[model samples]
Target: MAISLSAARLAVKSPLIAQPDPSHTVWSRLEPLATSDDVSDSLQARIADPLWMLARQWQFNELQGEDAGSPISAALAVVGLPVSTLLHQQNAVDAVTLPAGAAAIEALVEHEQVLSVHPKLNAQAGQQLMRRLRAAGLPDAGQVLRAQFPAALPAPDDAVADNAGFVWHMLLDQRAIDAQALASTLKALPDRAALEAFTSGLGVAAAQVGSAADLLSHWLGWLDELALDGSAPGASPYWQPQRLEYSFALGAQGDGPPVRLQADEYADGRLDWHSFTLGAAANLPGGPSEAFDVPPKDAPPPRPPLPTTARYPGMPADRYWEFEDGRVNFGMLGAAKSDLTRLAVLEYALVFSNDWFTLPLTLPTNALYRVSQFDVRDNFGITLTIPPAGWNMFEMSLQPGAPVARLDNALYLCPALNTLEGPPLEHVLLVRDEMANLVWGIEKRVQGASGEAIDRKFESTRLSTNQTLRPSADAPANGALLQYTLQTPVAANWVPFLPVRKEGATPANWAIQLQRGVVTHYYQVTASRLADPVNLRYSAFIERLRSNRFVETTGVQGAVDNQLQGFMFHPRGSLLRLDPNAPVASDFLRVEEEEVPRDGIELKRRFNYARDAQGRALLWIGRSKTTGRGEGASGLKFDVVTRGKV
Candidate 1:
């Protein structure tokens, strides 16, 4: 216990030595030199020392890069030519100067009334005309007109006769009314001078108004002269019921030769540059009209290039701390092996998002352009000339076995059309019938005379009632008796297409064409002879033939005649002509056998309208094709008998 009393001091020392924190030294404050005198600039998080930044870049392996210099300035010399002429039906004989807008072409091809006048609008126009006549000092003008020319006024409830043409027909037709009686009844007109003034205002010859027909004609003409929202029917000369295809030529102002382009399938209201193909090109003095010259008067003066930045949806942010849009979450995408599209999208978003650069160039619409010279100056003061080559994006590809070569280095800015579409007015199902050894064009829906969509099935059902004969009373009393049918009748909407040998093909060739076929209906006749009391003979049924006998069986005709006589598809040309003729004399429609697959296809036509950049509204009818519900059974059979519960 006394060991604690010894005061023995012992110090334990090791080789390790401790030193003060170097950051606490006053000299350390001056270690990081501020190159900028401004306090805000010095406070920035960015490293001021270039060497340190370069070292960090090297650590990130950014130094081992494409070695290409960043572009500082670029000069692109382009030339554009406006479309000057249009050719219809692919015929040079039908060529004419191009219209001011593509809507005219659409309206003409689709048979859409460019100046569509509704019944209400027609009535409004008539009321406005009457109001103007009254304002011009005609006392009780509306009442007097109604009383004197009762036939000219359409009944308020007569929707069918509410059109402008109907009013003209009733008023201006000599057969519709007695000219002398109408003239005598029109004595309510104050004097001949007043009548002449009215005729002059209507842009009609005053001397032609001697008869009632002429006066009514003048009145109808005056009604049309009023300001209306739409153009008159047949106003566009480009419209042709038989010809839907159109082509055009783009040319500079007396510079280079014109380039001809064509659109064979403009049935779809959407008119874009992709709709056309290079039809022809003329050779220039140098070599060919490879590029056109922009009209000097129309071209803008040379100016500095406006800088453009590239961006895309669902792109990752450049900085780690930056916020990103949550609407499109690439991480949430669950891609499977079969989801190649998703994989490609992910690759584009994550890997190649920043690989694109944008070059801004303003070009006129409805024109063809070509880059004559494109030179880019990089940060290293190196100028690189990029010549027109085959590596063009969104370039029109040469159609398979096309007669014309690809038009290289061409850019077409077709008339910009952004359309809004209504529900399909017509729907046709093109299906293959393996059992019948034929393909069918089923008219699911067809446009009626009043422009309403009618269900073809319902119409066929309604018309086909009591068409087929019932079993005769002469049938045998045996319960097991059989009844024979020459051929089962198919629905009128199911058109038949027979496969025929392709034209000009060798015997070894496997090509065939699907030609329109006819379906004939035959009636059965039973005959009984006294020689055989228990047995009876039935005559072979004869086909009831109509006058001219050769009918084009496009099933839709049975529901509504001449409904399908318009734009259809063919192999040689994208569009086929369906001629309107009598059922007995109609021409057969032929299509390539390969166009119809085993699964089938669907075609639809819908009403569409669009507003152009200049705020002009264009209306048209467009067509679309989609995958159909597989093979269909038409229930057609030959020489079949049923022994059922009857």
Candidate 2:
């Protein structure tokens, strides 16, 4: 029956529809979500509405009420003064006024390189001068130079001549130039005119001669500038290189209490206001307070001079639509539960970026500045005055358990010393030997006579070859093959420190201190059996060579005497005390127990030189500390028997 129903099909036509006209549309409106169970569903539904952003802001508490006003302008008054005088030593034994710029400061902190006309350095300087003369058109400048300024040869036994020699020998051929003859024919050319006349007689042009004279004068001027007498009382009045401590005054009249600074505090190159500690108040006979109507004892301490006022610069502006740096992507930052610093940074960037503002204050380098007054005027016509209450971000931190009051809001613009440090000239490692239960100061590198770093390990190896002792002739034949020794010889560079109790400590609270100790190397020699075996004891068979023992002293001695040049020690705990006023200098270098750790630490001393913004050359010797390679073994053992040769 279904097949029979398949008859001829008839085609039916469908009507065509046209698109709606543009002007015929009614007003459009977004349909609200049926269910707002999820906050995100409501946000997504009304995202196209203008009031959606406002609603989100309200949800996040962005409309909270606050009584704060935006700062429009700020004015700051500051008082600044350069350091005027320096007092050296704890006893205030010497006082000297500071020189202009950084010249005198460099002389105080840096060791004098020219001990006494070092021949090598003098020759080097002379060679540089000769090159300049040659460039100015004088081919025989070296001979003319020697003839003009004859070398002053001191007597053979004179101490000053110990390291000095004829400098021309380095530049000129010894065979061609007679040093003695040149010294004998010394012409007295005191002035420039005399020098020109003398050079003209040697067939040199007058113009060349003039240029040579100028060059010589300039060379001499350079030498004068570089020749600093570090030991001079006026130059380094308060510098104590041995202890790395100094005391100085900062007022124009130098009437304030001396400010004492210890360079060994952090052993870093930079020095700031935190380095200073106010010394005992001064007791001047006729101080400024005495000039007042009130009695000297009853009058208040002198107040600093009025400060100079100026507008604050580089203040931040608060604006909601302000463009921010896109590179700092806070969304991508990963933080762990314990990373409080990261979380604080993220919160400051996202929630409080516009709430905080920064105002920059600039001060001259090497000056101490105190903010006298700070006033801020807000957009709402409210003026706020901020007092200096040691609440600044750059305020000096107070030491724990210190008796001194918190430092005032004084900022010290440390000397503009962008020092270019040379490689460490001296390196010392302070390490602990757990097996021996001793602390050792290993002098890895020391300054040689020529101001070069000498590796102590290599030097000890070279010296040990000559110190070997042959087996004694009277010893048994078997002794030559196998030797029994009481102890092995320690490395000469490994200086020992013995643990000692504090002088005034109680039995229960005694603190251990490390005192410098000496190591003695003994030699044993066997003599023939005593002629009378019955009368002589065992001591007669073996004679201990006590007089031949070499005593190695503690502390590394440098090329300079009295001055602790290129000395560095890692101090982790209380710094090692170096009291120049003590009865004995060696006794005061006692280090605290915590200063020397089992892991060990390395300290280095290097020369640093820099030019400040004022184009003043600054030079200083600074110390640096770094973590050392784990532990060290000094190879020192007591009462040991060795089968091999000693």
Candidate 3:
């Protein structure tokens, strides 16, 4: 969007000026028009030169809208006509200056030759006459403009002559021309050719501009600058080449490795090659040992009509499962499992794979309490590796699941059971924010063996629970093993907005989001329920607080620099300090409480306070406080928390 200077100035109460947009292509297109010498004298002479009579006739005929198939059009249509060549090759004649006084104007007015063709000058004609007179050294005109006009015109140097064709095209293509301004500027020059050239060049520049009014304004201002001894008009510095750099990886679906590529575009139009590597370089497993053929693309079959009744009696219509072709479809119904658990599993499968029934098919028994002759099999070790090449860079992103979003190879591991003796095999899927920082994760723990005591040796480093693993149809023949997946219960939807520059970072922290219109920011407060893994399982909590201690406390921390900032979109259309009209806070504390269990009995409260550092009014909450029943603080209680950045 174009920034409105008037609006901003009024809002900020400052004399704001509009800055030129660097993204425009005008400067690049006009670069070839630059010249080193003043060719106004030659151009002026060519306008009245006898040698150019034929060319002028041709141009005049074309402008008069003569017959399309006229002989003149045919003759002038040749690509390399001598008249056209000569027109470009013509050398500028000596310069001529306007005589000081009204004598020149009077002579033009009284000239019988001029009057025979035209009775009286119109407003535009009169204006042109005045400009010509002034340029030719009118006594009342300022010498400053006269001196500057010549310098601004294209010079008589080789550069100008060689690109004469381009100059001609520019002039002829101009839809509008400020005749008076051009005449005034050219008349100041001594050489008639240079004068004409200057006028034509102005026409070209004006045509390059968006509107005639703008062209006129810039032209007059340029002449004024020359009068003050300023340099000639040229492209602004904003048009200069800008260097840019980018890096990303093309990732594949279903446990596939990624291919990374990085490149830098220099200001000089040169590309600097950077690093490239395959995801397997990080020691990831390669494709499966068995040969495989990719399935040909096929249009999905039409959906079957819904059944009038549930597949089983007492079943809700929406909750019924139907098998068509090879796919089984089912919807959420409280009769089978909680809506939350069912939706979570279904959604997860939808994101990672097309088959949502894979896990549920392994359930111990169907809700119908009928045994079906179906066997559940695992896709473990079924190398679904993606090729490392043939992908576009644009497909890469800075979000978890994207190739460029993470460096952790663990995220690609498929669900599997290693040894029956060891604890249940667990796999985690994590998601990172735009900054490539891990924000959420989910843990799927596959049951190992029934009555098997989990190795508690690593209890401190893992989440533990007392709940027995639920058995599934795919459970090992030795015993009934349950497989379950859990993720954090936090409902975080934080988004980054503004970028924060950091030294030596591949991708600097960008996007400081405006969480609430009130500028309330949050960080590490609660893990996202959607993507984050269940880090502190309730079982883990029980194990840690098994001691007799009546109160227990736990806190999680990560990179201290990760933070959130709040801001208010001010009336001026810019970010303003939150509560700008309020008095400065000497010590202001803000508190927030969230109901997690959907029951008022369990709660999580967050407290944020003013942070003063390096003379900046920063807001920070390094630590968190949690108060709950028994194993922790009894009932509800306020906790003063102060710690490091999370």
Tell me the spans in candidate 2 whose CA falls farther than 4 Å from its real position.
1-74, 104-107, 114-122, 137-141, 144-213, 224-229, 232-266, 281-360, 376-385, 389-408, 448-450, 458-483, 499-601, 624-631, 642-646
* Local accuracy by lDDT, each model: 0.50, 0.49, 0.24
Model 2 agreement with the true structure over 1-646: per-residue lDDT tens digits: 3432225463335332233445664323233332322333332224546587676555555565457677776776666455555544343444566765645343354443342323334444555665766687775766665555444322211112212222233333222322223322323456677767665665677667776666656665565555443442111334333323343433323334333332224345555666554333332111222111221111111432222222223222233334444455444566655667986775555555556555655445555555667787786988789777556457544433322454456565566556788877677788898888888878776544333455656544432312433333554655355666666777756767789986898988988888766555532222322333442433321221121112222342433322211111221111122432232224335666776667777767666677765776655554555666778788888877657643
Can you write out model 1's per-residue Cα lDDT over 59-100, one digit (the tens) per residue?
A: 544555557787777887766666665555334565556554
Write one digit per residue (lDDT tens) for candidate 3, span 1-646.
Answer: 8767566674544333333445742221111121423323322324456547655545434224433221111000001000000000011121122221211111111111111111111122333433543454342222223333211122111222124323433332222233334445444677645544444443334343233333334444443322111011211111111111122221221222212221111111111111223233232223211101221111121331121211332222221122233233322221233455764554443232322221111111000011112222222322222222333441222222333333321111111111111222222222233322212221222111111112222321222222222223454554324433232112111111222232343545432321111112122322232122343343233333333121122343454433222211111100111232233222111111121111212111111222111222221111111222222111111232334322
**Pairing residues by index, what is the TM-score of model 1?**
0.57
**RMSD in angstroms between candidate 1 and the native structure over all alpha carbons:** 16.1
Candidate 2, residue 640: the lDDT equals 74
The lowest-lDDT stretch of 10 consecutive residues in candidate 3 is 80-89
Which residue pairs in model 2 clash with each other? 87-238, 88-238
TM-score of each: 0.57, 0.56, 0.13
Pick the TM-score winner: 1
lDDT of 1 at 404: 39
